[model samples]
Target: MEFLAVVMLAVFTAGYLVLAGADIGVGMLLPWLGRDQDERRLVIASFAPFFLGNEVWLVSAAGIVAGAFPGLEHTLIEGLYPLVVMLLAGWVMRDMGLWLRGRVDAPRWRGWCDGAIVAGSWALALAWASVLGSLLVSAMSGGTGLNAGTVLGLPLAALFAWHGAGFARWRLPEDLAARAARVPVRYAVSGAVLVAVAVAAGSGLSWSDAAAEGSALSMTAVTTAAVLPLLMAAQGLVWWTFRGRVESPSYL
Candidate 1:
């Protein structure tokens, strides 16, 4: 029963990662999305279409956390004080940016809101990735597993910021894409390393555990083998296909 529930929760978590993750990636790259005023307008419009609905997964995830695992809620939230705060704060900032973009009058003023949206979205991405990385790197030991209990800290967050930079690569105007890409490319490299380390840790845990209970490790390996390369290739193709094109988001 517990196992089934956890597995379901993990699946839900993955769904959130794919959808909301892309949404964040889009925002992080927004400032770079266009070369000229028209392109930038299109970039902004790309977000405008689906901005509000993209976060439904988040709400669903929270409901699952609060309702499904009520017992773990207090402990999880209390122990991860800073992370929870940042998560909510980032959410607020990003959402506020979306709202304020509409209400504000001037183009220059709204541009500031767009900046906030990008910063908040990417900041949230880094924070989330770091916590997940810490979870992977923490020492996994015997009876209580207190070592694994703590979330991954700054190093992982830095890694996330790095990969997020990679996601920025294609989002900008053709000219800026290469320039803005330097940071995200580095970020992606670091994030890839962190994810690799996490995989290694899981493999080690699977080998050492007496009862062979590391289903999480098994699933992670299977998913990584199946998914990561495909995503890399797909993203590359996307970049190649759209290389010099302006933001005609009608195709999106």
Candidate 2:
């Protein structure tokens, strides 16, 4: 029974990682993908359509955590007020940026709205990475949420930002898309490597539970389910996108 519970929680975590990671990535990457007016607008269009769907996992996971593993929720989220606040703020800004950017008439106003998206993306990625660091270390010792805004967290944010940039680069006008195609491949590879290491660390953490012998395989299978599609998509993008050539008339 306990084993099933652990497996479910692990699955939830994996789901959240891939979906929410892309959400945050969209926010972070959008800022740099557009070099000018029309290009930025195209970049925004690239992600605005699908980003909302990413929230389903977060909503479902929250319900599961609150209902099934209520105790573990307390263990993890306790004293983590700042991260929650940061997360909420980011979500709001990103969404607002998505909506308002389109509505605004002035280019400058639209840019500000887009900038909000960048901030939201930046914030979300950092918060997630900080949480990962806490999970890895089993402690949020540096004043809990207050210090989640650390240098380490920033790198995670940078990665997400880069990820967002890739989305923008690919989705935007041909000239900008060409530039972005070059970057997404590298960022996707790095994000995958980060996940691989985290999976290794998680496997190492499970070493003490000799009785629960199946956890290693369970974790491996669950994680592979979440990441393999992403890996394949990235590989395909690299193979298909020749010399950063933007495929126009749209066949993504």
Candidate 3:
């Protein structure tokens, strides 16, 4: 059960890093990827279909931590409270921008929305990097200073941007794709590498000691086993449905 819980947690976390990373990266590079409003819309349309679905992975990972590894959850929440708050704030801001951008159809409103998307995306990336950096540092050095891990935040954020550029090259239209491809990296390869590194760094943590026991572990393991297949199936369906290059703006 403990092993199952750890595997599930790793799977969900890696899934989010690889899947939602593209969404956040694209949003982070929206201004560069899309020079004008129409272009921006097209760029956004590229990843819109997958963003919400990708978020499910993050939620599942969180649920796993809370249910199957309550000790780790408490430690993270206590140690990384500020970063968590930043993550939530950025998530809300980015989603609000995406959901509201098309509603007004006004230049000013859209501009604000665009700014929100960019800012929120950046915030999310930085916060995630900081959290990961902190964890990596703690695991490596046996220390718990929040500022110690922040040194890696900028570099990790750059990795996120690179990952986004790769995604853009694959999803955008010909002209935009050409622009995005200038970054010179393969999307799948970079994403895989990113996920691998994150998982490896996380593997250094003391998960066995932090995991829940007894009923809590059993319940979480069972629940994860039941839901994971459905989640993967749904994700596959969505990806298949929108596999083609996005030619125009989406409802986003």
Candidate 4:
């Protein structure tokens, strides 16, 4: 039952990573991909449908950790208190930017909000990556994992950028969408290389390690290793199904 709970938690975490990661990635790329107000609106509208709902998985994951693995939760919170605060602050700032962008007419004000959106998204991505990297390092070494996590910020940022590009390709239109289509391949390849390096640099724990131990950590690791790929595959299929030019909405 504990193993099952851990596995369920991993599933929620994977969902958050795919869904919310893409949302954040979209925010991160708004300034880069959006040349004008209409283009920027399209980029923002792409994920607007599910943006708030997607965060449920993050909350679910955190709740599971606090409920099921209280000790781990305590440790993680203590070690990453600043990051946790920053993550929350970033989200709040980004949300404000998203909402205010539509309301404001002043070019200078909109530009400032746009910059905030990107900065907030970048901060969130980097903080999340650092936390995961630290946890992975600590999991392997049975010690504090702060430094390695900080080091992993770049690749993860690139990975999220790739994610956003994939989304733009699926949801944007015309030359904008075509341009987005070209972005993912480059970032995906580079991000994959960096991730490979990170994995290789670590202690290289395997499925066998999970199977041998039958512990909570092992269950989480095994579940994540098995499930994340599947989630990503499904995300790709959804994108493919929705690919090509964005259709005009009935309201529009």
RMSD of each: 7.8, 6.9, 1.3, 6.0
lDDT of 1 at 8: 43
Number of backbone-clashing residue pairs for each candidate, in the order shown: 11, 3, 0, 0
lDDT of 2: 0.56
lDDT of 3 at 41: 87
How do these models rank on TM-score, best leading?
A: 3, 4, 2, 1
Q: Per-model C-alpha lDDT, please?
A: 0.53, 0.56, 0.87, 0.66
How many residue pairs clash in model 1? 11
Candidate 4 positional error at 170, Å: 0.9
Top-lDDT structure, candidate number: 3
lDDT of 1 by residue, 79-174 (tens): 556766787788788878867765756878777777778788877876666545444554344221223433544444444434434544545456
TM-scores vs. true structure, each candidate: 0.59, 0.67, 0.96, 0.73
lDDT (Cα) of model 3 = 0.87
When sorted by lDDT, best at the front, the candidate numbers are 3, 4, 2, 1
Positional deviation of residue 47's Cα in model 1 after best superposition, in angstroms: 4.0
Model 4: how far is 31 from its true place, Å?
1.6
lDDT over C-alpha atoms for residue 223 of model 3: 87
TM-score of 2: 0.67
Decide which is better by TM-score, 1 or 3.
3
